[model samples]
Target: MNNPTRTIISRRSRPAKEPLSKDIIVKTALELLKSEGSSGLSMRKIAKALDTGPSSLYVYVTNHQELSAFVLDAGMESVVLSNEEGVSWEIRLYETLHSYLTVLMEFPGVAGLALNTIPIGPHSLALTEYILERLHEAGIHSTSAAWGLDLLMLYASSVAFEQASRAENGTTLQAISASYRSLNDKQYPMIASLQSELITSDGEERFRWGLEAILQGILQRQSKFGI
Candidate 1:
C-alpha cells in the first residue's frame, strides 16, 4: 500500500477575448477600416496597428468576416430606430431607411460589412425586428414583410457600396454621369437615356427612390392583406 503513492498536476487554459468590448482591439480595427477600408482590414494588419500579436486578435476575431460583423454591429448602434410623431408606415419606413443609410455612411467601411449576408446577430436582428414590426403595423403579410426588409437592406447597402467604390476610384457624381453619357447609344439605350438621372443623384436621392419603391411593394401587400 505504501508503494502505491501518486502525484497530481494542475493546468489552466485561457479563453479567448470577445471583440464586443469597446476597447483597444476594436478601436484599432476601426482605425484600420477608416485608413484602409474593408479589404485593408486584416488580422495581421490590425494586430500590427494595435501593437499586439495577431494571435491575440485571433482570440477575439476569427477572421475578416467576424471583424466585418463586429464593425457593422458597432457602427449600426449609431442608427436611431423609432417612430416619427404619428407617422404612417410609409413615412416611418422612409425615416428608418434614411437612418440606416446615415449609419453605414458614418463608417463608410460599414456598408461593405453587410453587402450580401443575412445578418442575424443581436444588433442586426434588433433592427430587422423593428423594421418587420413596422411593416406588420402597415398591414403587410408576414411573407412580404420579411422580403421587403431584405430588399430594403440590399438596396441601401448596394448604393452605399457603389458610392464608396466611386470615391475609392476618384470619381465624382458628375464624372460618373459624364462617363455614362459617353457610352454608345446603339447599345444600352435605356441606360444611356437615363444615364444623367442615374449618375446625377447623390446616394441620398438614390436611396430614397429605392426605399420608396420597396415601401410601395409593402403597401401593395398591405392593401391585399388589409382586405
Candidate 2:
C-alpha cells in the first residue's frame, strides 16, 4: 500500500447509507430534549445523540422548532383520554386536563416546549381533536368550541411551562409552596387568607380547580345562549 493518499478523509469521500426515519429521528431528538432540557437541545446535539451528522436531522425534521413540535406531540401521547365518562364532557375534559398536566409534570422541561410550539404536529392535532370532541359533547357550538378549545389548551400548556421555568430557574414548586404560608397579611389580603390552602396545592389540585372554572364558564355560556 502507498501510505494513505491523504491524512484525512473528506465527508464527500464517504458513502451515504440509509436515511434515518423521521420517527427514530424525532424520538431521539425528544430524548435529547428531555436529557438536556429545551434550552440545551440543538440539532448538532440531537445528531450527536443519534450518531449522525446535523444535516441528517434536517433530512427528517426541518429544524429545532419542528423537532420541538414532535417532542410536544410525543409528550401528549402519554395523556390518556378516556370516554368511559360517557357524554359528560365536563368530567371527561376535567380528567383529560389533569392527565395532560400529569404528563407535562413527568417531563419537566418538555412542557416549556409545548408552551412555545403549541403542538402543531400530528400528535398535537390528535389532542386538538380530542378537545374539540369534548367541547362538542358539552354542547358548545362549532365556532365557539373551536376557539374555546384552543384557548384552553394554550392556557394549560402555558401554566405547565411557567411551572417548569420557575423550577429550572431555582424556584421549585415545593419551595414556592412553602413560601405561600409566609405571605404578608397587610400587603395581600386574599393570598394571605388562602395562602396555606393555595400553596399546599401541588399543581394537580390547582389545575383541577382551574379546569372546573373553565368547564363551568363553558356551561354558563351554553345555558345563556340556549345551546
Candidate 3:
C-alpha cells in the first residue's frame, strides 16, 4: 500500500489576531458582561473569549476591579447628555437620567457594576461633570450639588440593580402581589392597606416620582440650610 500523502499548510495562511489594547479589552469585557451578566466579566472568561491567556489581560488591566470600572464606563457610553436649547435644566436632567436607566436596563450586568465600581474613566467623569453642571444651573452648588450628584447616581443604580435582579430571578409583579395578599392586615396594617399602591404603578412612574422627590428634597434642603 502506498503511504498517505500529507499536505503542509503555511502559518501565514491564517488571519492575524487583532492587536490587544485597553479599548479592545474594555469592549470585549462589555460584550461578555452583556451576554453572561456579571459572571462573564472575570479575567479568565474574558481572556478565553479573546482567544488569549488570562495573564495577557493583565497587560492592560491591573485587576478585576479596574477592569470592572472600565466595563461600566464603556457601557455608559450610550447615555445621552442632551443639551437642547430651550430645554429646562430639570428636563435635561430627567432626560439624561432616563437615558442612563434605559442603558442599565438594556445591559443589566452593568447596572450591578455601576453600583459597585468607583468609575474614574473619562466617560464616568464626563457624566459627573454633566450632572454637576445641571445641579449648578438649578441653584444647587457647593456641598449640596456634590452630595446631590452622589444621591442621584445612587438612586438610579439601585433601582436598575433591583429591577434587573427581579427580572433575572423570575420575580414578577404577580409574585409580589400574591405575597402582599398573604400578609395579615392586623399584623401589618400599613403594608396591607398600601399593598395596592405598592405594586400598582409601572416602573416608569415610580422611577420618575423618585427622581422628582429627590430633586425637590435637594432644593428644599439647599434653601433651608443655605448649603
Candidate 4:
C-alpha cells in the first residue's frame, strides 16, 4: 500500500502543434463548418479547436469575412470540372454545375458562405474559369458570359442553401404538400390546380431542369441581344 508515485512527463516529449498558416486556418475553419454549420466558423471556436488564442488567427486571416471566403473556396476544392475531350460543352457545363451543387450540398455551411462571401481564392477562381471556358465554347462571351457565370453560381448556391435550411429545420416536401392542400382553392386557383406538378419531381430532376432552363435563357438572351 505504498503511496502512488507521480511520474513527471517532459514537455519536450509532447507532440509539437502544427504551425499556424493561412492554409491551416482555412482548413480548420472548413472542418468546423462541416461539423457545426456556419455557427461553428467563429474565430474563437477555431482558435479553441487549434488550442490557441483567438487573436493568433488574425496574423493569418484579416477577419471573419475573409476567413469565410477562404473556407468557402476551400470547400469548393472538391467540385469536379469535367474535361473529357469528346463531351459537348453543354454536357460538360451541366456536369460541372452538378458537381458544384453536390459539393455545396455536402458542405451545407459552404452554400451560405458562397451566397454571402465574394470568393477570391484559387479554387474559386478555377471554378469560375472553368465555367467561363465552357460558356465561351458555347459562343457566350463578353458580358453575356460574365453575367451567365454569376447567374449559374447564384442559382446553385441558392438551391443548396434552401435545401440546407430545410434539412436543419426538419422541413419536408410532405409538409409543404399538406400546407398547400389546406389552401382555399377558390382563393388560390393556380396554386391549387398546380399543386401536384409543383411537388412531383425529386430534387435531382428539378435541379437538372433548372440548370437547363437557365442555360436556355442565357442562350436566348445572348442570341437576341448579341452580347
- In order of listing, the candidates' clash counts read 0, 0, 0, 0
lDDT, residue 147, candidate 2: 65
lDDT per prediction?
A: 0.72, 0.75, 0.91, 0.91
Off by over 4 Å in 1: 1-23, 117-121, 186-192, 221-227
Off by over 4 Å in 4: 1-4
Q: Report each candidate's C-alpha RMSD, comma-separated, in the order given.
A: 10.0, 4.8, 1.7, 1.9
Score candidate 3 by TM-score against the native: 0.94
TM-score of each: 0.77, 0.78, 0.94, 0.94
Summarize candidate 1's per-residue lDDT along 73-127 as a digit string, tens digits: 7667767777778778677777877788776665557778778444755778788
Instruction: For candidate 4, write residues 1-227 as lDDT tens digits.
Output: 56569777899999999999999988999999999999999999999999999999999989988999899989998889999889899999888888888889876788999999997999999999999999999999889999999999999999888887788878999999999999999999999999999888858889889989998998999999999
lDDT of 4 at 189: 100
**How much is the lDDT of residue 125 in candidate 3?**
91
TM-score of candidate 4 on Cα atoms, chains taken together: 0.94
Q: Residue 48 in model 1: shift from native, Å?
A: 1.5
Tens digits of per-residue lDDT for model 3, 150-212: 999999988888888888888999999999999999999999999999998858889999999
Better of 1 and 2 by TM-score: 2
> Tens-digit lDDT track for model 2 on 146-224?
7678668777877777776676677875777667756777888988787667656756778877777776787787778
